[model samples]
Target: MAVAAAAGAVGVPAAADTQTAGAGGSQQSDIVTLDLYNLTDIHGHIEPVFDKYTSEAGLSHMACYLGKARKANPDSQFTLLGDNIGASPFTSGTQNDNPTVEALNKMGVFASTIGNHEFDKGLDVLKARIDGSDPTHYAKINFPYLGANISGMGTYLKNYRMWQSPSGVKVAFIGAIEDDVATKLFPGTVDSLTFAKPVPVINDLARELKTVGGYVTGADGSTGTEKVKADVVIAMFDNDVERSYPQMGKYVDGLMGGDTHKPYYFTKVRGAEGNILSAVASGSFTDNLANLQLKYDRKAGKVVDSAAVRIPAAEVKKCGDDPQVKAVTDAAAAKSESIKNTVITSKAGKFYRASQEDANHVKGENRGAESTLGGLIGDVMKNSFRTLDNRPIDIGVVVAGDIRSDLATDSGKITVGDVFKVMPWSNEINYVTMTGAQFQKLLEQQWKELDAKSSRPMLKLNFSSNVKYTYDPARERGQRITSVLIDGKLIDPQAKYTVAGSSFLLSGGDSFTAFGDPEVKASKRTVPNRLDREWFGQYLEKNQNVQPRKAKSSVGVSVKEEPLKDGMVKAKVSLRGLSFSGVGEPRVEKVTVKFGANSVTASVNNTLYDPNAAQYSAIVTADGIGHTDTPADVSARVRCSGRAGQTVHIPLTVENEAGTELVGAVQGLGVDVTCPAADGSVAGGGAPGAGASVSADKTPVKVNRLVRTGAGVSAILILSAGLLGMGLSLRKRKIG
Candidate 1:
């Protein structure tokens, strides 16, 4: 039963009035005010912690505010939108989010819709937690989880619930999640569940409640005996208000939205008939709670007025914590303290993750770009899953969003908690073999145009040490990737290579659909039971001391051509390079051209190559070029050189010395050289050919020779003598 509250207050409404007059004057206008409060996207933040503003944020403070509000308005009904748990800190995540559920139970959360994170551990685990079926670690949720659109195997959750106000006006609440849950959740989390469109389900349920009276369905498929006839219907969705309110407003009297964590209070959503519905959303991490007061007219069976009031976390004047919530949070924190404080290893220098400043400086924009932390994690993943099922992992991919925090800048002792903060998902590593073409497509997907009107248009990806690539944002979408190298070799589009990444990528999270292709997923292999956090911890422990490596330079080329007399062509090639370190100049060692079974090495035009600007421009003159009547293919290659040295110091395991410094290998970039055909005819868009292709020989060029010193010769002689003596002893024994 819904309890109504007194409407007269001194405060102004947050938005314009969303009320309609009764059709007839004879109908009695008995108005009752129902106070509804909502909280959303807490994400298991049980204890108070410093937010970006350096102020306290936690469930305890939220509970203090809730208690105060309920005391003032005793008829208030408290609800949650969803995303109460998952992707949480060590304190809550380690305990499987039981603390959050228990805290919510104590705080008297009436009902909630399922958020994407609720299925992070899969449907079975969610069911166990909700039903308290897991005797070992489980708590019974006092409120029901409502999902009207979800069906099939996990239909145990309620679709709707009915409550009647003290004034005898009934209100029905329906819950639903976004239709795209399958893509957002971890793979296999909701494989057996079917999510239908929210509109149809919400509308049908609303109609049933308004017309023939709806009944709540039990988890065990039992029918409820209580018939629910509501004068007002409210739909609670675990989706953003921008997406849900407009589409679902006509069917329900009010809406509770979640999943973006933005606060939107008392916005009126109008229907086709000019009927206005109220909607509200509370911000994430219990930062704010919304109080929506709906004035329902029993005679007209409609809401006469609606307004919302938001209570910010800072406004909670209470200094003490809720006793019950504190008890659960304290127990969880105590268990997490040991793990959080345990030292994983030590660091010699700062390992930086991508921050707003770093992203802006690196790419001149802020979507997400590569950083030192990304590089370190990529290296760790590559080394950990180098060989799986006898297949070598050629490249390791870690998306920019996965890196949560930077390593401690002080470079002192690194703790287990530090590593957990960086890679909190605990995602398992998986390997998939993809063709070179598919790999190129995978890289292309990283640069996304989120929407037509979005101002920010880039998403950067972190790659393993062995993988390097250059992209041109100025080029077309499929043509952006100018060059790619794997294992010091050019990526051959026709060749197949095994790549390693998290299950998130393999499950097609973040819209990297190239990895989630049905054929590629069929051949995916899990790297035993190793999780990303475990691998990173082990790597840190083994390395003992680590530091950020110097960034490498990515280079590309563009060519221009002019037709000359006597069947000749002049080609001007420009090589441009961008150093990720914001330093290190690029220099071209040599340039060569290949045309129609003929190869020519160009003369050294050292004057055009600029070390300061990191660009090289040269004009190559070719005689008797494009002389043939038939179209000929033309290609050019440039060998650019750079150096990388050891940036961190670590003790050697085999010998008593520091780790060896890395020697950066020479990289190459190529472009199709354009040439005019005989009689001044341009073939295939100014490039004289049907099969003109440019490629770089990624094989490292040996610049020096190895010399065996006296010690090395002596060791070989000693090994030879030992083998000879062993053979003689065996022969003597056989003769005897």
Candidate 2:
């Protein structure tokens, strides 16, 4: 930190050092250096890290950064990627992002994408938040809130326009939030608006922006010059570039992404073919800002080149032990000290570090990062819910993606900044109701991906004494499910179940399709500001002896398979479904199946590869497996097996390997495989060989199954002579 300050002294001498001077180096006639400024996931950290009034001071610093950028170049453009609303601290959350918005508004944010948190309170409340102030309602801002790729004036606003520079250069900005925003957040937040996929939506917008002025007329009724279309495109969307950057880059010049809490800058190069594109992500976050310089060649009407600098850390003037940041921070320290000095009660003990080891939800036991940290947060969230209303949380579920860092043994000395670092994104908690069937479907999907060797889907669950579950990775993806209970009763597929989870999962974060069922809508939900901070406060209050345990492995997942090849395989396999009692327990069931498999599965587990049927398996790890009495308390591996056959009935049971049910079944497993050439001929373009077959006769016969002997397949006529003769006779009879 000291080095950064010294470097700043040499690198940034004065406020002028903040100014980004100079026109872009690329002077190509076809290039335009369009500098784009963006902000996202600020999390309402209005003050400096340690200072009391530093929050206001921090605001002034940001202003200085922005003012310098403007002074350096009047042509610079600014946009926001979202998540600037919900999950904020008391300062901004209670005030509904007013200060944050005012700050951005002051700095002239042209447009912003709607983030999932923007809908935390529902659309009406958000609308009220934005419209309450006259400046926001009637600001000179021409940029519209773009969502689902619908642009300008009509879809998000009536202005229906693109920002064109004074030199007649045009650029279109499209806004969109994560698709799951529909469910991951409260329905009240997005009451009626529907969201479409970002790619198609952006493509449609790009087309409109490219062609809006394609036709024009002169006053004399003669053909006039068409309006010059956009030379560059900026998409300020509340989606992560990590997932769709490559594809998204094709339709836009730059993607300012958010909702992931991680800062990212991506540049897409449109290939010789306008559709051909390449993209890369540039990271950004709290205390770190991405400074992007876009050099567009006005003559060429296109961006030639771009550069970005990531500010490693926030610049805050250091203070002595009584330093303001330290002072404010010390106050909390002093409280802990005073409490310790007054009474010598039983040691709270050091807070435990959660790793992939230990058992029990007990405070002293070691556990996986997700279990310990996630559980702690869930408890706090559940408490928050209780504080807000009399109704207690039925169950709390959150994906591992939401929790960025693990609690460490040394974390007992946690600081405000440290807490913010762990829960950086500050996503709001959302609730949705799903049926038992849908819940099972969601689990099946999770297993398919995780067992297939992708990322594991770990969710924090706070069950309401009514639900319990058990898992068996011992069988195949479909068969790994077992033992579900709800309200002390077995789960029923037809029953409705209430589930608590973040907006991300309900929106399919883990590819859990069942949760996205239209009927699985949200009910009572609250998007609290700074869920982690609130939880941290509660954690400190409850436990005095906090410590983190050493990390170790707990849950283990292994996949067996060969590298998979392209194409669909037709085979049936039974898969276990998850369910809870009261909601009815989900169970493993026999199923008929035919599906496509991904190549990544083969790459991960080549031994489990099925030559004929597409099959894959993988191993996943969950910490603290041994000692949990929690309802969903169990662990085992799921096995997936594939074989060559015309059709196979794979039983979905809690077993360790493929069963012997098909031991004596039919065994003529020869597969009819062919890779027809572009010319529609067999490989090598030769006549049918001994084993390979083609038509022997020129006349085509209607045959369902043709047998191959040598040279060609023996064709059997399905329309027998008798049937043909009978048909003729029927015609004759009609004539008579």
Candidate 3:
């Protein structure tokens, strides 16, 4: 009778109650302040970014937030939505996914669903990272990883686990990857398992809670007969952003997740009108935190007080005090220190900040603003792989978005911790084979994409390191690709080409529609997208002397011009940011000039502003090379010859002991070369920059200079370029 009464209290059928209960009636409360904390898509950015020297990163900050949530209310519950891994930066990727999990364990996450990135490194790597005996991968973790819709591995691997709060109320958490995990992962990563739609699997699990006779399911699926019939449902999923599901909010109490870079918090969801529903968004690669609070009542099953939203500064400080949180962060930091040298040394050029007005990094000959960082990362990953797998990679494709911070080649030491701060998640390596048709399709998409305006905002492919390919925007889309090769061998359109990529890409990330081509064939899987993991492993195994130094550097410019009646070319040229040494300062570097594929005079200015005149010119341009007067910086442009039918690409090859980290986006220019028309080809004209014009009526770059001669004696050039560039250079100067 008591069990029946308790079930009725929460709106559940009383007849289903089977457990006997004591007489003292359950306590009920009105105005329950359920604190719901949601942590979704934490790609291992565990640290906090306050300034340069003292930022905490990745699992540390997350753990701190969790500790704060626990204190905010003893009743508060923690949950994660999905996509806590894959496509992570060098830190977790290099480390094999262990330190990240250790930090999560310390954060006290109760439960989570599987996100697409979770499978990026392949299943074996995931398993080893999660359950490895080594301290790095499986040290922490007492929470449950629930996957209901995913079939296979019944007893082989566990399912959704439960976690009971101090109130003895149990929450059942089930995890699910997007139903398309097979396509997203290497063909074999999940060979032993399959996934199902998240909604049905979660609903079925929720119904089973009734079988416990009013006992709520807790972490590890343990059941207990509590007078309160409340159950907290946590579902983690990674799905296409286009497919909206209102039912998820209606059905679950809390959902913290990733896959989409956007954040979604306490917006009122429908089904939870009387209850509470919340979703946590992907943890910002930089600048953000999320929280979810869960509260229960005798009237409603489980209520989400708040979902994926930023934590107050006061709360951040509070969580920082937790011992468990600090420990996890320390471990990651320690592990990060191991691989810091390798990445720094592998950099061919230095990182320059990108302006808000400029396009971010991409993988072309010029490399754009993020090219150097991208190059260094690619080199490190490739080199690490070679050492581990005993094979050299043909080409490497790393997205520019993955590089969160500018590489500090100009005296700002980029440590292992710094690498971790920049790249925090773990994604393993996976290889695939694509037919000539598929390869051509991939290349064609890029050319067509370049021709279209904002057809895809998230398309920046950084192909640096040892990979080589040519993009002739002069040809029609799909046919623009003339050739594809591996190790200098010509690609046969009908034959398969082995390609290396992050598991995320193998499954198709960032709307890479080409990966799904029918002719593609995927190879075996490996562990870690986090380059740092492999870096550390290799360093430790080989125990070689690791030294960080800058490598290559170069400058590129893009100019757009119109043929006037006078026969002289009238055009606009943009001075892209300077690309410099990837690891150390350039031994000897100089920029060359060219005009319409021909030689042109080039000169440079070392100073952006003439203090004597108290005036500044658009930072000078050397002959054709844009070299800034600022030490270790170069940005300029030249008035070169232009021909109506000829377009030339000036390749700024920086030859040093190694590669340079000079990647700048060439904007303010357009390639107007006409391509041969093909059957059913889309019309392309007016160059890519049709509707844009030069608006000098803007104040985007500002300069502030300060001289200091002390222990760290330095002259700081505080040049506030655009937003991206602001994060780099500006405050620091290159030392001679």
Candidate 4:
């Protein structure tokens, strides 16, 4: 450590030689430069990976760059701001990111703050990782994990740490993880830890570091006290650059930020107290390096000026890989190489997980859209149990987050390593034998099952290829799912159906409370115990080649709730969510809309490489219905590049000339209809001779809400068709 301090003194004066003007005496140089290097949101990417960026920072390259910085400034130390590990690629994630810690140790990283992902396995595991106590691996983190504003920290964690520069300038790094970390994590994953606002807690600690050390409540639960000693304070915090709070300049000279993953640098941030601070943030996945240079006036006993920059480590070429870090990386790669390289399917083709692209062509995962990879995983989950039980699994579900990446290989072979990168968490699959009613609730829960919304407003769940559904976002939450069909038949509400999914989700991870409900799991048919990764591998083995499906499993449909006019029952309909927002994806070309007894075909330009959204508008007219009280169903069948979408029924009322809403409530997998109002205003009111005055522009006498008769879908579909066959004029057919 003494050599490290001395090395940092390169091109700097000794402490005694630099002290000047403190007592207004003859002065020497007053400045001492201290350099500190930082990395954030590395996300365990120890291996070199390439994408849109021209260059990539594998640990070896990053080490090389940091090595140069350290040689120039011997007092400098490498620090990580958080997310140094977790949510990793297969090379590091398979071994619980042990290699990442080993690599960091080899690089001589001084300290780090805890990222939200650090708590992915909970506090016990984090402590084990911090203290070299994990039973399976022996690689211990050689440095401390700091979090000043975090409560419930174990003994392995500290609030702040100290670093001394060669010119005798000591820096106190006070750390605070992002304040809203818990919202991004799974429920109950961080129940024991409480995160407070970072800026306020940081100010309080800096106050203590600069003044007398004393007893402070909640500083440590057991001791209720803490005292930090240092000459000046720096910040190691996880924060969004936009919300980093310039107020921190009041007590700290420089700030290091992470968690949002965007790289940034602020040369001068003026605090309320007129002090200036520098802030730096490095981009995610070893893409960038952040540096802070502080000029301390030893005689003045305070920081005078500071500058910071976020270096683009990826672009600087010709930096020879640091041998020590390369050795560590090589060992870790060798440890996971065998299984990762084991070929699962030689004939594997390209498959994609859904994503949304920005104007710059940068892609970010969009969990709201249905992905082909998600569909395939869903198939595997259900098929794994196929024929194993007397009754087949009625449905399978895949959470979008579980499929982390797309599948492709330059060698035309997909390996076990490839699958691990996509599904590295290794969540176990479980079957929940829930009632049909519960399934409906689960489907509606795609919007999140709470009155309050989540950061991601919608987390779309992918269903087995056999399942299809339609919804209307115009409807209120919890009542959005309009139709659900399995194998061309309506889902029976009271029927017991076995649904398979990962244990993480079935046990209520990601806010899916429907699967974790006690009543749903209470069914006698509920089953458990299957590895999701194992099933995926088995599926690849059995299928031999990957077949990509282009059609989306779900679509959005909404019909204007207006009265049917005259002999022609005309209603305008709006449809969307037909396009899959993925690379190399095709949009819907043709949509056959069937409403009530009328069917209409609309052209949607089903062409490959068309840079247009797949959306359509159409009108359905029922000319035969007079003023009866019967309700009708509306839905569409989408024709895409690969296949056709499901035609699930959407419930709608047949309004009368007086604009009275008809009673139609389809429950389960049936076309159930309720009786209309006694007034003749509703079509097919079934009231003795309902009124029949109809015009689109006519003013409505009154508005009646939808009525429910609770008729079974099977009986209604059959009876309606049979009645139309008899030419009884109960409903008319129109096609265009």
Candidate 5:
């Protein structure tokens, strides 16, 4: 069902396949069908690997699949859209991705575009990989990397390349990387390179190749020109299909895109001239191989029909590994085998790195929240570094994106390969001394509104066991964090402590500018000669058995009530919960307070609180009549508005101590309270026209004198005199 066939090539015949009369009334129709094998986001995974679903994934399986497709259709040409290297596993990345390049060469990759990851190391390294100028390899790359929008870097990259099919039809492939490569890449990786607008560059190149033909300058500065024009235009981009499809589709007959790691069997977009353009993206990591078949009318000089098919990795029947590709990957695997197989430790339960479920009832792992795996990694960082450096590590932080995979084996055994896959960056462990204020600032940067208009929300940071913090998503950007405690003690804003983290963070990666400030950078000290993965492995070996601690829930609530004038009471409620601000998770739903027979609800206040504020507060007023005599017991509850739908409650009491005019003030809330009297006076005295001074410990009582003029007053006086005389006569008789 994943494969879609156009013109019924593999199924029932369709009308498009039937021959028709020519435009000039001459019967002439000849179609040339060619197959294009596309792969993207390989990430230099050379050896055979298994996915979380236990399915076969890797370049070896991909090579096998490509071989089968090529055999089935001898005219098939293998191509890589982009992201073939960089951010790779140790097997390939350790060797500068040379093994992957060698494997790709053996698999007969014709051409590819430049992905953002290709610029990970620098432009010079990328050039060396392309030209094989580095001493690692004796031969240059077999395929050319195209970048039509790239400028100012160097002349090694070509804008377009033309390949002539067996049927004598020339196909022009124009390639371009993502437009925002500069933003996504590291600080100085692409400082000298310019990524021009893709649409105009692609359109201009297409026009030149079609009208003026192909021209290139020789190595000695001699210009060589070819008068041959391309019969069909195909555009390949190293960006998301949805972002590049419409523009590329307008000019090209076929388009291929990547970067999202998703597969599109066939997506037909209408062009500017009403012509249908077909595009496809092979999935990432050899999970699936995309096959695009194009039927070209040689005489018409256009692609008449197009179809796409997705061949899953599992469907590639076991034909053993391709000997040529196997030799390359096997050599790389052999170099890493010793470390890969070495047992580091055992886990009591599975440590997840990402979401791995389909059912709604099953809760998937979130990288942005406090996760068991994150906590485990953070603990390893702190404990290992502390042991090695012989210094106290107050806190350890790790970004969720750096953690790549999960430890899902039922056997509980963990290997060096497992750790490598989880942390493939090879980043060194670094330490920086910062004040609590600066540290809190660094934590606040974790949640940011990158785009005001988009739904994409902020990322969360993972902290170690020594750090505990609460955030209120209902609050504004800098004030989201409510409370921060280090080692069970509230952090002092002026106290200085050493923090452990990756060099990436020390250098201010992920917008953590607080870590990169000159003052903070001055205190940075990297652990001598130790990588993050190595530290983790050493820690695991020493521990032998490791299990993640149960992470504390970040949601909390507190309430305070104060008595006001005219039997009115104000309840201040604070909610501490993590929300994605309408991005991934919902915001705080509502906060309600119930006291006696009255219930009141509070809404979130839009005004941002101070950075050191404890919580987001909302005030609700309720009337209290009978509460004047005794203390009022109140309960406050908060609920989240997101999918999790969790809630928290706190009980508080508003007390008016006996003999103190019954002035009420809420207690057990996280905020200070002040009560005012009903007669526009301070409850603690200091009012105008006061009669007598009242003591702090006692209530002030007043008495009124009775008037004897009224009949009721005279009757009360006569009855009181008679009762006194009778009581005296009875006493005298008893005495006699």
Candidate 6:
């Protein structure tokens, strides 16, 4: 269906990717060319933005490119890989993503796979948007949402829709979403849905199209009248890594992937039978479009060759935006500006979410660690829910994943738009009663099973200030949680406690299924759920000025030791989970370990290069007040940014006084003192450098230097004597 004449005449675009494959031959009447264009992870970016912090390419420019490309080749079909909506910006997000729908209608897309974010509200809300049944939204989407691996759509979804050329050369476009979408959504919203692995599903569909070549069937297996076999297959998945699914190239000529939001193209995936498949990834934020072309020979009934090129969104500048799409984007911007400017709170301190640092110390958002913002949100939710619902909730919980943005005022005032971006899902407060054992299970669930398709190996759930816990990641999964305390008291395993949070979390969102237990779900719901964003705004407005939590509510503490020795001892204590991301979270610089009243020198080797660097060693000695009969009290502490204390009392096992006694033998004014046991315990390899010890009753005094040898000591006395003699001569001359 793709015409060669409509293409090439437009000339090369600016900064177009140089990657291209399979040039065409001369005078080919039997050849059929199909042009396919795709975009992924738009996330409702509909308006052009050029700001100090960021600049978005927006839908108007994206639509301009699509219009020109499709017009140049009438044989083409505009399509999307995934992430057409949800997690949108203020312009579209404020209006329930209606502007995005309107913009997509102007682009004229044929079909799209479902990104995980599409399920943010639930399956029903997604359907309502797709069919334009909701009167509150904008326009009806002309594109069909396709997913071969997803069930519970009844008959609305399709697997592969064939596009036939004039001479009957058919190319089927197959769509399948990632398998783990269910885990990322609210439980009640998707209880009826089932998402399967897309790799096997795509393989099965390719095999059937190649061998069977029968009538197309609906999602429910209802066969349709149209019958055809694909001469070429282009598969779309909600993944960026082409290497992850090596077996995918069986019958596919090209692939488009999404959901890492990285801008990259030109990866070759090896197909079955040693055939190489061209893999192309467009960019997120509507920044680029992946263009793929295929040449099929009618005589051979197979695709002869294919090539791909990534078209950047900047190319639209040369051609300009489509007038109709630009109008919609501008309208959206105007509509949301008032709400965005409405101040929600006065000037406030910054609150930052968790982030991860790479080996080179480059940082980005990480949902695996706790942060000050998450803790504050948890407190806000708990207090607001208790007062509003008239319920006695023992604990409040909020996961790192739920917090999408931070609260930092650029204009010296917090706005509604800023708060909305932080809690965009508009989740409501829900209460569930869970026993202490189940709560422990939920805490243990932080270390989740690693997924090939997902990035989070561990997810952190931030609890209110009243809750404290310690975890050791080195331990087995279920046994990682060593202690859990609520309200300064050890949690009783049999006690029933009511916890409040988003309905998604209360129902075990993000795979924390302990909260989804039968007893927890069946608990009485005496009051109606309150929207979390409204409550949070009220909480902030009442306080006027907000500040981040100064210290971490929960900490990770563990100890590793060699055999115990009482005097002049050393030990390694693992101080981990201290390196949290963002300015608001405390940044631990060094750790200190104290034995009785004697504090020894310590050194820490914390680095992103090694996971074992969390283990810091400090020298502990029985030299001063540590010279006690009973075990000396050991305190492990940390010095972090903006604060100097996190005193964690840890137990130390010191060697008994029996072996440590210095055996003194006196004979004619010569005394022999034999030290205990040749320095073996916490000795040898990892001990810190020895330094002069401080007495138990006094502060440390810094000398110019330590005089190590006898020669150095004599040199100091000679200098002192010369100075004294010079002073006496000067005094005698003055008297004369």
Which of 3 and 5 is ahead in lDDT?
5
Candidate 6, 365: how far from true, in Å?
4.2
Tens-place lDDT digits, model 2, residues 698-735 = 21111121222333322111121222221111110000
- TM per candidate comes to 0.64, 0.52, 0.52, 0.67, 0.67, 0.68
Clash number by candidate, in order: 3, 84, 103, 18, 0, 0
Report, for every candidate in turn, its global Cα lDDT versus the true structure. Answer: 0.57, 0.39, 0.42, 0.60, 0.57, 0.58
lDDT of 5 by residue, 1-736 (tens): 1235322222211122223332222223467666777888888777776545434456766676667655554446777888888767778877777888888887877778888878777788888777778756433566788899999757678888776654455677888875666544555678788878776788788877777777432323244565677677778887655445556534577778787554555545665456677777776767666766788876777777887665556554354577778888889999888868887766545666423111111122233444556667788777776624587788888876567556556787888887887787778888888887787788777664423211113345677877765443433456434446677566666788788888876667656778877888888887877798888778778877676553232333332333322223234444332222111222233334344344444443221111211112211100000111112234322221221211112222122111111111121122211222334333344442244222222222111111222222110001112112211111100000
Q: Per-residue lDDT for 606 in model 3?
A: 23
Write down the TM-score for model 1.
Answer: 0.64
After superposing candidate 2 on the true structure, give the runs of residues whose Cα lies further than 4 Å from its correct spot.
Answer: 1-32, 50-59, 133-144, 148-161, 166-168, 214-228, 249-251, 267-285, 315-371, 378-540, 546-554, 559-736
Reference-based lDDT, residue 302, model 6:
73
lDDT (0-100) at residue 294 of candidate 1?
Answer: 84
Best candidate, lDDT-wise?
Answer: 4
Candidate number with the higher TM-score (2 or 6): 6
Error of 4 at 568 (Å): 8.6
lDDT of 1 by residue, 342-427 (tens): 88776545565432211011111122345666777778877765665575677777876566555653546888877776677889
Candidate number with the higher lDDT (1 or 4) = 4
Q: Compose the digit string of candidate 3's lDDT tens values, residues 1-736.
A: 0000001111111121112133222334422444545556666555554543223334555555555445544556666656665545555545655556666766666666666666666665555545554454444345556566777745324456555555545555656655655644545677777666665665566555433423445445465556333366566554422122344644466555555444334344544224445554433442334544444553655453543345422335434444665575566657765555643333222443221210111111111223445655555555556413555654555654455555454453345545554444434666556665565566444321311221122234544344433322222234323223344344445665555556566556544567766545334345454444345345323422333324322232333333321222233333223433232323233333322333222333322221111011112111111242322222222222232222222222222223322321221112222211223111233222322222132101111123222233222111112111211222221111
